[model samples]
Target: MAVYTHVSAEALEALLARYDVGELVSAKGIAEGVENSNYLVDTTRARFILTLYEKRVDAGDLPFFLALLDHLAERGNPVPRAIPDRAGVQVQTVEGRPACLIEFLPGVSLSHPTPRQAASAGRALGAMHAALRDFTPTRPNGLGVDAWRPLLNRCSGDLDQIAPDLFATISAALDDVERDWPRSLPTGTIHADLFPDNVLVRGDSVSGLIDFYFACTDIRAYDLAVTHSAWAFDATGAPVDAGVGANILGGYASAFGLSSEERAALPILARGACIRFLLTRAWDWLNTPADALVTRKDPVAYLRRLEWYRANPGCFA
Candidate 1:
């Protein structure tokens, strides 16, 4: 959710004319995330989101993402559906990039979530996994364990610039994670990047689960691990709030029970989750342009999480 490409008023009006969303009253750029260009669009009919698929997002994968949202919305998951144009086209070309007008779900993204809010988010995630159980479309996890080492290799030159001994430490962690990566587990379509901002809450309940850009076919527990790593930690990567983590697990369990095998694999899966964010953040930190309209996240944050996971393997137990 960043603004790389700027659309002029005339261009925006032309684009809006393709759909029945009415004349554009206002559109503002969203600058929170680093993946795509997003704008909070308002029109005569209603509010909506205009997302321009950025370079990092492969245009070919737009159908999978849009269809996933449709499927989840059909099953009553709190997800936004892509709005189709007058010609019944969901995907459209806007400003020379593939784009979509997304349904604007009503909710606010929480920065510092309470335990009860975390529990609601967990339940939403569990229900999402359940809804996706019968979804047959399969897209492999592009950022899975196998892709970590290569991603790390790309960031090797600038690893130590971010932190001391970061390269060697990440290399060793990758070695261990690859060596013991889970062979078999219950797999399904997962919201691989279930960070705090991706979830929208109305009071204590989840109102929307936005951002399906990173959703893919992966291990079910790994999705939980990603959510745990995201919601259970502070900005400095400290596990200061035990209540949040506990309630998240409890709420998720109440909705979707994890097998004993999945439970046993949590620690390692969490380590893998940490590595995924650490590497991607490092890459973005090193490569993103200084003038880019996006926030550059700290790679050291996830480094701290990796250290905690290593020292406290039984943290999940």
Candidate 2:
């Protein structure tokens, strides 16, 4: 979120006028995410995250995302709530981009989590699943396995530059994931992309989970799969201490228990996690501007994880 769309101070003033959040004393670009443009917005009343929905975020999906945020926050979930404007609207147009002011959540996202930290994140993930149990509306996971193939195809022709046979490797892995992918499993609100960066921690406990842009109704264990690959692996994409993975499993079991079928599907879902990040990394690697402020992560790291999962499918067992 490193200043994708530059909003001047004058533009900020106009945007602030639409909301009752006092004055815009300072606004600085937040250097956290690769999607959406975010600013650390401060007003006379309080601080907030001023987000300008980027092209990657669909305007049609705005209502769902906003409503979900409101729902989670109201349930005492540790998520940022969208601040409604003077007109009682949470979303508006600023600099011709869909924008919203979100209450600033406290705590920092952990880059390298210990086993204890992973346990806290796992409990938080389970709690999130339970808290949203009654959220009536459902949003399908657009980035689920169905969406992986086209993105893989889009990146196929250019993947040779990344590594020999990389495209074929991913294409084959996609086939495996789809073949083994569960047709019927526990489905609910899942933070499909619960990577370490999206999970915030303060002290030994989880402060909250953020970045619900990828939130959708999917297999609950799939969320754990996503988090497993995210939290149980080092930056090198190799599994961390075995205890860390077990710790996550234990924490998740505390609230929403995983069915045996869900446990069995974890391997394939974890592999899907690798595929999801790999395609995006490959696509962004080829497309991101050279001078862009964002860091383009090497796609090979996930490729390593894919290979490891293929060799040792008992990662979550």
Candidate 3:
């Protein structure tokens, strides 16, 4: 939510002019994101999310994320459709970073989701996975295994202060997967960060999904694993409520039944998924400047989560 790139009010006004929107009525910062400067823009035409890419987002890969949203919207996914400029291009440079205006989706994210909400989120995620089943466009995984391993090593010295057991367990888990992680497990386009905060809901249904910055090509089962790590776990990484896991998995299964093999891999993948987030948060915590306007999400939160996963390994079953 930091203003990494400076976009003036005049610049925003010009952007509104480019669209059919009559006038820029107002603009305000939307919190909860760390990688980009996002503003909720209100205009005569409609509300939209204007984003200026930051250090975390590679401008080169903007096309895939934007195009993927377009593809999903075209495929009937309840996602925000990117608004194109007068030149008919959905992506363009604004301020300093690659910028795009996305249609503002209605509804709020589940900061404290109930079991039913969790299930509904699962259903929506499954639908999104199915929607992008055959999407073959190429893009590198933003935080692929190789990119991730180095961070783990960098943070190894601090493991004792954080969560020592989880640190060792995660390192071992990653090693195990490196040896036998499947080369093929239904690969395709996936929303790697399908957290509750990224999902918008209206009433009992999921209305839209936002923040495609982490979207990329990866194993479909990995997507499910990421979703499980987000929706099914508590602050301590233990299953939140008795029915949370069942509801989520059940909803996803109804949408696209997981193979027995896929089911077997879920627990391991979930552990790896936890480690991925833990390392990323640690990297950000160590690297992020103290003066940045954005809030640094706690790396220790995921550390505790890893510990809980280690204690209650049966929860993944």
> Compared with the true structure, what per-residue lDDT tens digits does model 2 show for residues 1-317?
55578789999998888877788889888765678888898899889988888867888888888788788878777888778888898888878899888888778877778889888888888888998899878888888899999998888779989889888889999998989898898788888888888877888788877888888888888899888887777877887888788888888988678878888888998899999998888888888777655666788889988888889887677
Choose 1 or 2, whichever is better by lDDT.
Answer: 1
Q: Rank the candidates by lDDT, best first.
A: 1, 2, 3
Give every collision pair in model 2: 1-33
Per-residue error (Å), model 1, residue 29: 0.5
Worst 10 residues of 2 by lDDT: 288-297
Which candidate has the highest lDDT of all? 1
Please list the C-alpha lDDT of all candidates, in the order they appear.
0.91, 0.84, 0.77
Error of 3 at 205 (Å): 0.7
Candidate 3 per-residue C-alpha lDDT over 1-317 given as tens digits, one digit per residue, 9 for 90 to 100: 55555578999987777777669988887656578988888888788888888888888888778778888899888898778877787776777667888888899888777888878888888888888876768787868666667878887767546545656766776786566666667778878888888999987688988888888777778888888778776654545776767777888888877887777777666666777898887777767777666777766666566556556667645
lDDT of 3 at 138: 74
Kindly list the per-residue Cα lDDT of model 1 for residues 25-68, writing each as its tens digit. 99999999889999999999999999999987899899899889
Candidates sorted by TM-score, best first: 1, 2, 3
Question: What TM-scores do the predictions have?
Answer: 0.98, 0.96, 0.92
Residue 122 miss distance in model 1 (angstroms):
0.8
- The lDDT, on a scale of 0 to 1, for candidate 2 is 0.84
Question: With candidate 2 superimposed using the best TM-score fit, by how many Å does residue 78's alpha carbon deviate from the native?
Answer: 0.2
